[model samples]
Target chain A: MSRRLAEAFAPGSVAAQVAAADWRAATRVAGELLVASGRTTPAYTEDIIQMLEELGPYQVIAPGIALLHARPSEAVLTTGLSLAVLEKPVEFGSKANDPVRLVFGLAAQHHDSHIEVLAETANKLSSPRFVNSLLTIHSESDFQRLLSDS
Target chain B: MKILAVCGAGVGTSVLLKMNAEKALRTLDLEAEVVAMNLANALEVQDAQVILTTPDLVAKLEGTRSEVIAIEGIFDLNEIGEKLEKALG
Candidate 1:
């Protein structure tokens, strides 16, 4: 069976109230979680940063969420997800979606393996109740339960 | 009708845009085929009636025959639907 959004979450990757100095810092935190989960190498983090430099703030996909990622590369050992809820929102320079508080780091080994989770996440985020729950997530368990709920 | 969702990498954000655009079209009761692709591939497609992409990528699609719509957020269904309605009408 294909991994769902909740199943694709790397162990110990969900965090709450993380402190980040800026958008780069926020992305780094998410990348670190992906590293700790054994999903990608340290180089994958830099790849994501490089993508940001090249692509601009297009990762800021919603009002308060930034989905950080790059094209699937060898740096990705396996597909996984890292989520962080910022203690203080940071600007990613997107005019429509500035002051992002939630960052999701995605590392996919292929073009399509992770699409299910991505689509699931997008659908859940469209719900105001789900967004509210995400903003108030107090623990990793809270985040996991939130994902499973929807 | 066809719509192309364009992004830098094609495989990531554009997929999200394509999904939301599908939902928006469904709500609007409009029928169209939406495809997700990278910037380079999007530029080559000639039959698409509309192209949905981020604000930054709007400039990159300068000469495409399709009408380009710049969406503020890929997940914002209301924004996508409103823009699609105006563009299609």
Candidate 2:
């Protein structure tokens, strides 16, 4: 069976309406939350940045959404998810999916781990209505509600 | 038939794409051994018939024998299905 988003979500890892000047800063915000939640080390953030700089921003999976991650390493404490919603959208240099506002930082212990949560996330984010609700959420509780939605 | 799902790190989005590709293949009434691997490893794969990845990753796959297809939306099953259909046809 597929896992729910909440199953892999890190506790207190949600940051709402973060003021980020650029996509890097927005990714940093998400990474920090992941670090604070004990899901990953600070090095994971730099790894993600390096991956983007070296390979490109293919992590911008859809319109206004970006999923930040790197290869599974010692930096990742476990498989967990963190979220950061920007106060204003920023570009990740992807021509097709640009002006990203929602950033999800994922730290997986293995290559195949967390597939269920990732699928759940993909299913939800693929819907425009769910994306809009996540973008417009006013509080962390509201965000939780949206994330926990089946 | 074989399909390769690729990304910068084989661990993240490639797995997402791999999952969707399997679903797309089922929707298209097809079958293939879909594998997700990092760019470095993917460069060494000589058996796959198709490689699914984002557009930016396409330029790096020049010497590979597989037909590279760039998918814009990793989560969009319909897009994946359509692209796989066209590629298979």
Candidate 3:
């Protein structure tokens, strides 16, 4: 059951790139990637941007972790997940855990159905070993292996 | 008992918090219905005895009659349960 959810990270399919200084730029890049992957539409892409604008810099759980989300309205064409590793960590008001280097953006349509997936992702990301692995990962295959073994 | 868990999307962390809070309440033998919703949906969800959310959203919930419990660490189950118990009591 755990592996079923973990397998969502496609080894070679995971696209990674160094983001510019701005967080919004990074979100747009991820949104574009999702659209390119056929996970969402152009309209949905704009919705993701609006969501970040309205609810963003979600530093409430800050200090290295930010959970970026939006309403399940016109923005989400389908349930999707994507990751962005900032070249330089950015601050989102997480004083206790400032400077977040990794961002895992989640989009979903249902309320409670995706809870298990988010919980699993949070548990995996919260681990020191897992995060360290992500930092060192150079290829999509490496990333997928990390999820597989996690 | 009904509890409203609010966050940015009402889809991600808030839902997780709701799950953890529900588990905690169940451990205490408290019967409750946890409804996860966004801050925009807060006005629609009436009859909730307590509100669980981050400090930012809680601030916007000012002047409302609902008992508000501002949870700093949404992932910390202990803090969430403690705040929930105090607010709902």
Q: Which residue runs of candidate 1 sit more than 4 Å off their true CA positions?
A: A1-3
**Interface DockQ of each model:** 0.63, 0.74, 0.57
TM-score of every model? 0.90, 0.94, 0.86
* Candidates in descending DockQ order: 2, 1, 3
The per-prediction CA RMSD against the true structure, in angstroms, equals 2.3, 1.8, 2.6
lDDT for every model?
0.88, 0.88, 0.67
Mind giving the per-residue lDDT tens digits that candidate 3 earns over A15-55? 55456476666556556655555555656557756765665
Against the true structure, whose DockQ is highest? Answer: 2
lDDT of 2 at A142: 79
Model 1 TM-score (B-chain only): 0.97
How displaced is residue A110 in candidate 1, in Å?
2.2
lDDT of 2 by residue, A1-150 (tens): 233567677667888888999878988998998998899999999999999998888999888888999889999998899989899999999898898999999998888787778877887777788888888877677777776663
Regions more than 4 Å wrong, model 2: A1-4
Looking at model 1, residue A87 earns an lDDT score of 90
Residue lDDT tens for model 1, B1-89: 99999988777789899999999999999999999888889999999999999998899899999999999878778999999999997
Global local distance difference test of model 3: 0.67
**Native contact share for candidate 3:** 0.54
